[model samples]
Target: MAKTVGDFILERVQGWGVNRLFGYPGDGIGGLVAALGRNDDLEFVQARHEESAAFMACAHAKFTGEVGVCAATSGPGAIHLLNGLYDAKLDHQPVVAIVGQQSRSALGGNYQQEVDLQTLFKDVAGDYVETCMAPSQARHLIDRAFRIAKSRRTVTCVIFPNDVQEAKAVEEAPHAHGTVHTSQAYSEATVLPQEVDLERAADVLNAGKKVGILIGAGALGAADEVTKVADLLGAGVAKALLGKAALPDDLPFVTGSIGLLGTEPSDWMMQHCDTLLMVGSRFPYSEFLPETGQARGVQIDLDPTMLSIRYPMEVALAGDSARTLKALIPRLKRKEDRSWRGEIEQRIARWWREEEERAMKDAKPVNPERVFWELSSRLPENAIITADSGSSANWFARALKIRPGMKASLSGTLATMCPGLPYAAAAKFAYPDRVPIAFVGDGAMQMLGVTDLITVSKYWRDWLDPRFVVCVLSNGDLNQVTWELRAMANSPKVPKTQDVPPMSFAHYAELLGLKGITVETPEQVGPAWDAALRADRPCLIDAHVDPDTPSLPPHISFSQAGSYAEALVKGDPDESGILTQTFKRVFS
Candidate 1:
């Protein structure tokens, strides 16, 4: 007799440290769910939707540095997962998606819940596979899932055939066989370019001009190296938002974020610097790139593939950030460039001061960014923050300053809507003692299933005073896309979709038995967030926002703008509606 595929899945998942599953189960996945129920080590999440399940798993994996798992049945359930998978891939967030297949006997017979599960996600998932015999292929699929989840840091889906899931195992119990490999990359010392390359680089730095370092995601673990190299070369730090946590935001050598949506200081610094050191960052927006009249960028990355992919570069060097920075640190002298660091420091201080002032502002509608910053200040050290895309994520990234030792997870792409609630749930699942705050736009919260907060509340409440601060900015539109469209294309007035109406997130939250607050005024944001965090269970602060005040778009190239502007000016639109839209924006 052959053991069932579901049993083998549980056995293998146990090896990968997967104790719980996240998802909404349908009839197609029943056998697997039953198998999960039988296994003590593996539990099920029971999310409100399949998309949220994948998102929760993605967030869990990002913070825990392990494979986070989610599951769903066939057809529409499986379809819901693609959007989240796209985001996980771009951000390199680790996740495993286990979906059900139509019974094996139903293959090519026009089955009810049928989908070519493996092929459907081939383009998006780093690894796509299906389970067969539990003793052999099932265990092997588990290994593949873990590998893709770890190496590619993206979603890996295993479609379990219903009949195969019910088959008996040849062995008394199934065996799981995924293993973790911890190999270190070794670099052999190479001869330096005889002081000439260093001389040129040093000359660029020592010139009587401003110098800056632009940071990105690749510098996460190499903050010290980046800092040391900057200190030795007298370069100021201005990081991409994705690299926000790379170093202490309050560091004296720091300016701020540089790009279109960036602070004024970051814009000034990027424009003023004569030499720019690109360390482990591959920021996509070209608008933030220093103009040709200003600074020239020198990119340093682990892979040469990232160089010149998005923006033009003066030089591209392939090397580990820390190792390269270590080599460069000693060769450079540490003399101040007079007003260079001082000017940046003053600008940063001014921004910080304005941020402080914003914290004190009183208005009819609370600013979401101001609320996030306030909530961040009150949270305990090392508190987890999971943010969805849109205004909420932008505000969280902008306002929730990353302290050196603290951990965070935010969607680095724009594929999914409501990842916040599920992400917070996963963070709590992994570290129950450390409360995780999930920030999301109102449009996203509804899309994600906020009521599922009760599911987590059921098991983890005893972790004591459950502090999952789900701050929902309720302006009722997908503001991130709207803002981008306004800038990228001359779309007149913000377009309104008749697909959905203004939603009440606060009402829905309380219906789920979680504590809730409505922040109609800015004065109430801090107090509301503080109260929610102090509550002993799940809570939400429906922070009403001014929909009119949109998050500005990040910078990009003038050529791209010229193309769109020409389309607008030449009265060339694909449709009358497009022309009408363009007219609205032009007038606005």
Candidate 2:
């Protein structure tokens, strides 16, 4: 039997260790679909929508640290992948997308389902994008796509025309440069800094009496090293949202999260530190950062491009997180005075007390924090959690405690909705033995949660375990946007635009042959979580939380306070009167 270009592409992808491809079937990709059916090594996950497939691929890469792959037909199918692909690109995850195109003979004819994918994906896949024009080009193009994606930690796109995919492979061809059948493997190598760089970083740390550390997802494997460095320098550590798992919450001097959705102590630590050591993070929001000349800085990143991009650095060390920390630890001088660390720890303790107070509030309806606090206590040590954007993210950021073994992920860069459910499904597929939970906003859940629950039911028994839970924070409003309207602008709420109809996501789950639980009060939150965790199939928990609870920053500016005041004066319904409730929860 003569092999086709599709055969070669699948073989190369399998060789590179991609065991699954998430996509939807369509006419533009019929050839590739046929090829996917022939390859037993690759399992194709059929999503209800191409967008969810792309989101699944992005989540898979985030969890496994490998180049995740997704496929789609050209035109609309390819366009549907943009949102999730952007999620991967912005977060610096390795992902490869394959899109089907019209036959070469029909080029520029405006054929049915024809579109220019290269231009469409240029921004998202700036690192690599090309069409497979011939059978001989399959091996080189596929290998290069994987190589660039893994090495650069960016997205890569390959467009396959229908005719080209069906073409028979030739032993010798015009496009052939080398052996077409040879196998090659590639892996990202550890990057380390020079001795001089490490010494300079140590000098920066040693000169300051009060040092602070900002850790990101790049520092995931270097928790011990990061703690050692912090202990040696008497530094308080603040984690970026993506880096929440870098250190356990129980660590005394570590602040949970930074920026708008951050703890009060983290903002204080960032403002007061004389020197800042940044590892594996290119955290934006320079407004939250120390002012110019406020602190001497040392930044360590594997990508040289990211070093010192956020702030001016006295020393920039380009290296792997664990290796760089290991090298620099030996040259550091331990601080004798533990007062700074003690003060920061005290602030952290106070912050936790505040969080607990907020969680324990007995508002008329239900406090959103109560649900997260219950989940925090009930979550398995090894659970993988996903949070959708909006108020749900604020609760997840502030309330959850990410232990050393646990993993938490969000659309940090894209900040897109409708990804939480897909992310949980992907995590469940990737780590079947581990529990996967999605903390999703009512808006985001209504957008795709029910549809993806069907996908979950389809693949539930395909894996070793079926323990997936989707927690819907149903407040019947776009709570975060509403808060933004009140907190950022001194305007009355746009009643029609911001409010969502009350939805029964739990009932929707049950309709799809899955378990469902609805919690309207504080007491029901814990028992609902308990039921979801014990269920053998996927479950949904619909939590009716207070919509008026404001996610106020630790340090609210005068202007922001004025804005909130103005909104309250200008006919903003103090309906649940949760503003006073929330105010006391934060200040009192």
Candidate 3:
């Protein structure tokens, strides 16, 4: 049989080194599905929904430095991919989404499952989104999507109409006026700032006695450079949530995550520093940073648009984080005064002790902080960790101590829910030998994680090492929002909107032929993780943690405290537990 456009599309993506495509089956994409079945070079991962598939693709790009690809049928399936694609776009992951459209002839007729896919994908895939009107258009569309996605480190789209997908393949475009030729070749440029700018940044750093370094996801590859710079300047380093794994938490001068889910040491470092250097991170909270002009600032990022957006910088270096830091290191003068670094280390040590004390405090049942804190010590070497939004993110951000070589991430800019399991699955696919763990809340588990468990069961047997674990904080409440109501809105928890229905996630995992463990007490948290890690297959730990455990910010203001008191006075449903837990956390 002669090759079709569908065949060429798959072949081209495979040529670009895409080993797997994540999507669900639908008739609109029947041609591509058939072609996929015939081809053995690419693997098709069947996700429960298009959203999960997109999340998987985004995670694939994040875990591995490759362009992630996801496919879906037209209409609702295409719409479902928007949230996950936005996650990729906002977090700056390279992902290409290929969606099927209705027959080309029926596009404007408003046929069944026909939607304006071009306009629908415009915002998320703004860098590039094109429809393949003919077989001749397939090659360039596929090539451009992958190239642009990789080059821009953002989401791109290619729409394939059902009719066009089944048309005969156009392996090469004709050498004519209207025809366009494209190549699959792409290489990352070495982005470096001018020498004058690097020297200026170094001058600002050397001038100050108290220096602070803040890094985000962009600093992932420049860990050594960041460390050398930090050590030379006798500075403290704080990680943005997305850059948690950029530096190991064991470093005394390395403060943990910064922001609402941040540590006291990081907040202190930012508040007191006279000089600040921000690398490869666009952490959105300005209040968490030093007051404008309080500190002389230098910012570094690959994307010029992101430079100096968060903080007013004296020097804005538009270049790759690693390379820029490497160039700046030599110009920097080592600070002989070790007082600032020593002070920062003392604060970090005290903060960790406080964190341990907070985690061990008694609660109604299991304390959620305890769950993550226990897991931190038991995490296998080189394990990949993913967390969902909500209270789980709060704990994952604060309690977990990410060591060197362990990879960790979540929905950073989007802060969306339900990517935990999908990300872990993608990480496992990227590195089948490494353990992948997910920390999720009951709400996210029900929304998406439960369904993705079946995806895990189906693929775990083929993995070189099958030690995937999903740790579900089964607190029967939308815990994060519930606390936000009390602390931010000055309102009591409205059980109608905030309570999550109780379900046995462990039992659900068992039903899918995976190991399941239930942990109701704090003592069982550590043992359960051990069992899950040792299990021959994927495991789910249903940890029934206390909903009243508050995720306190590093610096709580008077207004926030007053709001919490007012909410309690208004008669919260979990008033007693909240009071008890809050007292222990704050005063204990």
Candidate 4:
């Protein structure tokens, strides 16, 4: 039998060291699916939907630093991949999406499932998106997609028309004028700033009495360097949400998360610091940072464009986080003043006590903060944790204490929902020996988590450790958006839009032949997690938490307070509970 274009593409991807492809089956991609079946080297992970597949690919890239690949059919299946691919693009993860197109002859004829895939993928896969018009084009398209996705750390796409996919494969391009030759070779360069710039950045840090260091996802590999710099400069370190695992939370001068879902110590450090060094984080909220001109600023980022856009830096070094910090550390003089570090440590200690007090506050049933706080102490070493957007993210940012060696992330820039389970599953696949836990809300669980559970049930038995746990906060409300209406829009929550329909997520997991536990009281929260972690298979914990428990910002402005008052005056459906919870959280 002659090798087809589909078979050749898979062979090329396997050559690039991709061991798995995530996607769903469809007739448009029948050729590729058949080729995949024939190939034993590459495993195909079947996701419930194309969106989940894309998310899995994104998470794969995030967890394993490799180019993740996902495939789907034409039209709706291809469209479903957009959101997840955008999440990859925004968060700067490498992902290659392979989608099927209709027959070439029927492309312009508007045949069934024939959408303009090129234009559809242009925005998400803006760096590269091309169609394989012939067997000869397949090699270059596949090569370029993987290379560009890996080199650029963004999403890339390759569209395969149904007819072209089944055509005879062309392993190599001819050495002619029109033919193009490409190879599956890419290597990440170690970027470092010039000595002159590193010295200037060091000078700025040395001159300041109170220095603050901000780390983001870019600093994940530079933990030791960041710590050395912090200790030498007597600086307090604050983490952006994406960089939660960049540094351990147990450090004395390490303030927790920064920005809206930040800790008081982080906000305080930002407000009072005399010099600020921002590393590999584009945290988006300028108000949360030190006021302009009040502090000397320096920033380091691999992407030159991201360098000084968030905060104006006197020295903007375009380089890798670990390497830049290492170069800068040699030039920095150790600060003898220990007063600032001591003050920051005191604030952090007080903040944790406050967090504990807030988490333990009584609510209608289970307090959501307590769920995460309890999990923080029980998180297994080397565990990978993912949280969905919504109230779950609020608690994830504030309550959870990420220790060293534990990997954690979410849809950082996109802040999208329903990626938690998919991310965890991808993490488990990447490190079969490590446990992966997902913190999700009922709304997200209802949206897609429930269906993805079957994906877990199917794959768990093969994993070295069958300890995938999905912790669902069943609050019966779209709690995050509801609070945003009151705090941001100054409007009362409209029950019709804010309320979520309840579902038995635990029961659903049990039906899929996985363990299930329900926690209706605060006492059950800790025990439930213990049970789930010990289960022989994947487990789901349905924690029925209070809907009115406030996800308060570290510090509230007068305007936000005014909006809350206005919303309450306008008669919010849960005004009484909201007021009570707000008071308890504020005064605790």
lDDT (tens digit, per residue) of candidate 3 on 196-274: 9998998899999999999999999889999999999999999999999999999888999999999999999999999
- Per-residue lDDT for 342-433 in model 2, tens only? 99999999988878888888865778888898888788869999999999889888899887799888998789998998998888878989
lDDT score at residue 279, model 1, on the 0-100 scale? 83
Q: Residues 264-295, candidate 4, lDDT per residue (tens digit)?
A: 99999999999999999998999999999989
- Candidate number with greatest lDDT: 3
Q: Give per-residue lDDT, candidate 2, residue 175.
A: 46
lDDT, each prediction: 0.68, 0.87, 0.93, 0.92
Model 1 TM: 0.83
Model 1 ranges off by over 4 Å:
1-3, 126-135, 170-209, 292-296, 302-304, 314-328, 358-363, 454-465, 476-478, 481-488, 492-504, 550-588
State the TM-score for model 4. Answer: 0.99
Model 3: ten consecutive residues of lowest lDDT = 579-588
Off by over 4 Å in 4: none
Off by over 4 Å in 2: 170-183, 574-578
The residue-by-residue lDDT of candidate 1 on 1-588, one tens digit each, is 344667767777777767878888887787787787778777677776777777777777777777788788888898987776676777777788888877877877988878787678887774555555343466556776786566655677787777777776433333445532321222334323334554555555555266778887667778898888777666788877667777877787776666654666777777777777788787876566666647665677765677756556665666667766666667677766557778888888887786665544433365556777787568777777777776676666556666777666677755356777777788887887887887877676666555556565565555554777777777656666654554566653344541125766677667777788888887777788778877877787878875545444333457546644554465532335444433432343
Better structure of 2 and 3 per lDDT: 3
lDDT against true structure, model 1: 0.68
